[model samples]
Target: MRKREIVLRWHTIGLVRTGSTNYLIHLEAGNAFLEAANLSLSQKSKHDAATHYVNASLVFKKDDPKKSIQCLTKAIEIYTGKHISATSTLWIGPFLSITYTTLYTTKFSRVIFLVLHLEMGRFTIAAKHHMTIAEICEKDLVDIEQAIRHYEQAADYYKGEESSSSAMKCQLAVAQLASQLGQCDKAANLFEEAGKASMENNLLKYGAKGHLFKAAICHFCVDLINGQKALKTYEECYPMFADSRECALMKKLSEALEQENVEAFTTAVQEYDNITRLEPWITSLLLKLKKTISEEEDIT
Candidate 1:
């Protein structure tokens, strides 16, 4: 009877879809579940309590974030402690199973916690989330460093879920930010990674032109040898993209870069712009690369 009662309580706490309930009713249901789950403070019960608390917090997230934080903190405490062991975790089958809900619960809770911090104007909090968190980290807070971290986190998470396109976009964001930080090699690698992810997802734009083009440009920013090698490698990887206009532009730019001729590079860029405006980001990187080449010539 006690075990049956515990299972029922666990069901109540675990599957409470707060979005479907009235706010007050959800709160009441949550409190009741918390009470039942806490009746016995075994590891299973503590885990239930943590889950219950997270659901409870989700109810009051908009109006009472501080309360939500307190509840989430309790949840975090249970999950991070050494008590939830592997063997014992197996015994607590229903509680610690690797369901979609189970796997994402901790990650989602952290995202919510960080989102709450962003809402409260706490810009210094760890940047982490699905999508909104990355936007807030980069667009609102302007913390490029943290934004990059969160974007990478998001990419990894999406990759785990087999969300290839979504993962590609996150990788693209990380690559752009890495370029901005002047970590051009890192940016090039990330861009190549994004391109590969896109191709794996059958994303035509990125697979054929977008990411490979950007990767080559990132290499260009570093030096002519690396840049030409990157372009050659990109063409070899995507033979279909070898004849694309963007690739032609890259070839022309490479010649100009090799010659350290600013006029030729500028003319090539303007020629491309006259037909189809280069992405503003690409234009900016090109200008930066031009300046680097010019500076190297002056130094020599």
Candidate 2:
């Protein structure tokens, strides 16, 4: 008779609307009824809870998160009622944390919470979502170092998983960010790293341009030093040119190395004219490269 009464109560509770005050009363009564009757819900109940959680995630995606969180909490309660394992609990915990963190805001606490959420997204293979959150941290939070860290992490995750194009783009983004932060060496290293990864993955056709980029950076560095070493570095990079811009610039650089004065400059102009007939844009850059080379040569 008691078991029959408990079964009736459970059915009534399940049929009630979860959003109503009466539903809360039923839930409390159902818990007591289940305990008294020694009746654990079946696996079907747990599966239903999982389904509800997924549905709630979609519904709450852009809507009222507080309501979504309520639904998720109820779903979790259902799962718990069926005695779901701790591992499953771990899986659900991050989602709950994400929701709570979104609801609450504090000056110092927000930073910590966002980092936690970022780490959670990273661990879950949510690269696109993780990148978005990282950008928020970098821009809104003003945590440049943390932003770079997440960007690098996202790149590595993509690269390690064979997402070559995405990984390369992520790496490029990090390089650009580093450059903006006035960390030229770090940017150079990231570019070199991306280049190596591209080559090792047989993506050289896509990555070959990076070698020339590195050479340009080295050339700039050389100009800063006003030493023969800079010119030598440029020479080393000259052979890697597959682009018209690089090829033209290489010719201009070679001419500059040979000619040191106004007379040599006149000779270079003639040589440049001969080269420009083959490629006109190259001629335009040659003149600029000549000026740059001349200035550096004077300083040296």
Candidate 3:
């Protein structure tokens, strides 16, 4: 081994052993690892460098999270081939967990490593992997937009695998985020797709009612014409929904919005809520639909 590589390794080991007590030492050790990574003769050395960077990050985590994330990003870029910014609210925990756990265990780690580096032809595994990462972004980090992108990727892979149920599962998650983001048209289309898919499955047919109901509401947010058209289509596809309370509420709200009658819209929602409690997400979207009528009335 070269004199520089040997020196860098010794420096890294010494600094890391003493770095825990001194933040500056920790930072210096990180810098040394980065330098070693650049001069390293093998992938193993580079991997060790990345691991050391992660250790340095933990030391900076409490006092300066941004610096910690920058270190983590540097470590990630070594493996992921791109630098992730600290400004983005994405939790890097998933990436770090995969790195640490896989490297330490060396079990299924090789499979994932092959998948990442080689881009192996394992669509189902890749799809499921991305889905897990997407869930972490959504549920833990609350980064809905990032989660949507991952879910879309997972859905595409699932489709390629001819896994209808799994694809719809991902699509449904994206639809929920779209509704929250006020992308009414996208949400409506995705929900409609989910409803159709669910109706085709005996075990999931009951969920079709909920999906169709959300679809109509999303279409309503777009406009009354689209809402009415969607309602008719949903009713034709699933006759059970036509007789349901949710469908009746949608019809009542449609009439109320068409006439710009705020009282009628409020009454319809109140009556529905009294019978079956609406989830907060549903209630929020309903308010947005109501806003359209209120705005139109103001204009007229």
Candidate 4:
């Protein structure tokens, strides 16, 4: 059993290194790992069986995210049964909503490692693995709120890494997604961090303007005074972008806000849509913002 297991693991790793681009190789790797898992089960080695399941799930992630999620759900479900805790359970929100490919396409290998450590009752190792899984899921999960939670967890984990700029991109991803979801306050804060991160890393100098712009827009969504201040700061940072269409779009919204013209704001959004279609989430957020602004106007 040991020899067979070693061979299967080597086959899986070798294939991943040399032939990951080939779908047939992934299929072969998956089959070999599945066989190894079955062998472990037959031998009544729960630990080894779980390991094989984790490996197989990683092998299948690229070609079959749906199956990967199933394997993850199985591993998580098993781990939950073994050790129940308030802290562990608190972080399992995204995992709880795991459906068979109807929801996410994240890498599940870290999640598998988390499960392995959890089963062994190693809280420290499990916590690190948990953060890694959260990062991966934050990049791929469809649910905005869940993704935000993952991003927050990931920033904490990633802050310790040598390259803080790379961590900033993770923050940027969360901020952009949050803005699209109308979580304006959180988005503004994240975008500010992204801007500062970029400024600190000369490599991201050109990208700072973009981050600040997004942050300013998120601030704009929350309140007019803060919005104008943020927009002015962004203007000071990237003066050349003053005449750009994106800048104009923000300006148009500001003008509408000053006039309290709901119809003009809606029309401006529609006009922007004519030039470039907004994402569904962005559309939803814009409509919500418009509704809120209109309601405020009705009060006085």
lDDT of each: 0.66, 0.48, 0.73, 0.62
**Model 2 pairs in collision:** none
Which segments of candidate 3 are over 4 A away from where they belong?
Answer: 1-121
Model 3 per-residue lDDT at 124: 64
Q: Point to the candidate with the largest lDDT.
A: 3
TM-score of each: 0.60, 0.40, 0.61, 0.56
Location of the lowest summed lDDT over 10 successive residues in candidate 3: 86-95
Candidate order, lDDT descending: 3, 1, 4, 2
Q: How far is candidate 2 from the true structure (C-alpha RMSD, Å)?
A: 16.1
How many residue pairs collide in each prediction? 0, 0, 0, 0
lDDT for model 1, please: 0.66
Compose the digit string of candidate 1's lDDT tens values, residues 174-202: 88988988889999998877666566655
Pairs that collide in candidate 1 are none
Off by over 4 Å in 1: 1-130, 200-207, 297-300
Q: Which pairs of residues collide in model 3?
A: none
Cα error, candidate 3, residue 140 (Å): 4.1
* Candidate 2 residue-wise lDDT, 1-300, digit = tens: 554455445545543423345534544443433332233223223333344343433233233334433444444344333332322222223123223343334366765565555434432253443454456556656666766776777677676566777776777777666655656556656665655555455546455544445434434333434323433443454334334454454445455454544456457557745654423433443354466757767799
Sort the candidates on TM-score, descending order: 3, 1, 4, 2
List per-candidate RMSD values in Å: 10.9, 16.1, 9.8, 12.1
